[model samples]
Target: MTPIIREARAGDRSALIRLMGALNDFETEIEENRADASAAAEHFAWVEGQIEAQGGVMLVAEAQGRVAGFICYTFEEDPGAFVRPEYRRHAMIWDISVDEASRGQGIGQLLLNAAETHAKASGIGEIRLYVLEGNARAQRIYREAGYRNYERLMSKRL
Candidate 1:
């Protein structure tokens, strides 16, 4: 189903938080992670702060007068001096998720496009996000959106 993409409003906070919790649960199914629903709520303030402090965008997709999904993005500082100036302050898709009932209806893609529009308006030329290696569904969606896996983050039990 097509959704209305709009900037988040005060009334959307609760629904957005609920979606974040759902996102944590969904990601946990792909790979065991340290975060859960409670952690998602706990860290949401920091996410909000990052967006506000940095000229970012928080968008929600509404259908039938309810928030079906949301996406949050912000500009990230350059990682190093060696990075190219054009992409130094790249946009980061901090979070993106659609509620269970809203899945498989193209809501995610619309949210992504909205985020890209927001980034472009802010003079950003690149956007990046991380998805678990096992999240093949999200991987496919992102790849189809032209997001490439140009980097790898490796970790080991230490």
Candidate 2:
């Protein structure tokens, strides 16, 4: 199916929440249950706030008139935020998720491509995202999209 991708509207907030929840569930299942529902809710709220404040763009992929996936990204021209100047030369893909039922279809790729196109139009030279260490599927997608790993983000739970 040909998916129509467009900038997200206010009406898409609820659909975005649902898609995020579904994506979290999928990740939980794949990781043998490391996902926390409360944490997901909190993160979603933070995402909403950031969207409101940072002027980032949210792109939604629609199939059959329903939101099948979404991608949120930010363009940076300054080095103030968590994004550094070097990274700012490229768009940052903060979040990208497709519903489980819609997996394996080119929806994710389409979303990423849309984000890249937006970035290029905005004068960004590159794009970047972080995939969990074991997320081979996502890594594969990034690689296929012409992204190469340049850094590792290590974290420890305190």
Candidate 3:
């Protein structure tokens, strides 16, 4: 069944906490520099704070009366002198994660679509997100969605 995509609400607190923990664990597994997972509630609260401070939005995919996944994003405007005008204003995805149990489904895509719609409706012309080099699955998903390499971030191990 298709998941219902909607803005997260107060009633989703518990599920949000659970989902955030799952996300942390997933990242920790894939990124060598990532720290071990912490309490799930902290992740939820952190995202909530980002949303409050940055005018961000978190869209959740609800399936079977639970939050199957979520996408958190915000519109950003960089007025730096060196930044080109067209690239100054854009939407950035802070986080997008789906529960392990829901991994094979299209919930992630649904959440992404909802976020893109939200960004476009808010007048954002483009969207961007950061994915770890080890995350081939996520890279493929973004690529399939027409997201391409705009810039490269490389790391030098000390």
Question: Which residue pairs in candidate 3 have backbone atoms (N, alpha carbon, C) closer than 3 angstroms, thus clashing?
Answer: none
On residues 72-128, what C-alpha lDDT tens digit does candidate 2 reach at each position? 887545457776666656666777899888889999999999998888887788877
Query: How many clashes (backbone atoms < 3 Å, residues ≥3 apart in a chain or on different chains) does model 1 have?
Result: 0
Ranking by TM-score: 1, 3, 2
TM-score of 2: 0.83
| Displacement of the residue 112 alpha carbon in candidate 3, Å | 0.8
Best by lDDT: 1
Per-residue error (Å), model 2, residue 71:
0.6
Query: Candidate 3: where is the Cα deviation over 4 Å?
Result: none
Order of candidates by lDDT, top first? Answer: 1, 3, 2
| CA-lDDT, candidates in order | 0.88, 0.80, 0.84
TM-score of 3: 0.92
Clashes of each: 0, 0, 0
Candidate 2, overall lDDT?
0.80
Instruction: Give the clashing residue pairs of candidate 1, or none.
Output: none
Question: lDDT tens digits, residues 53-79, model 3?
Answer: 878798889898888888898777887
Candidate 1 per-residue C-alpha lDDT over 22-109 given as tens digits, one digit per residue, 9 for 90 to 100: 8988877877764778777776778899989987889999999999999998888787778887768888888998999989899999
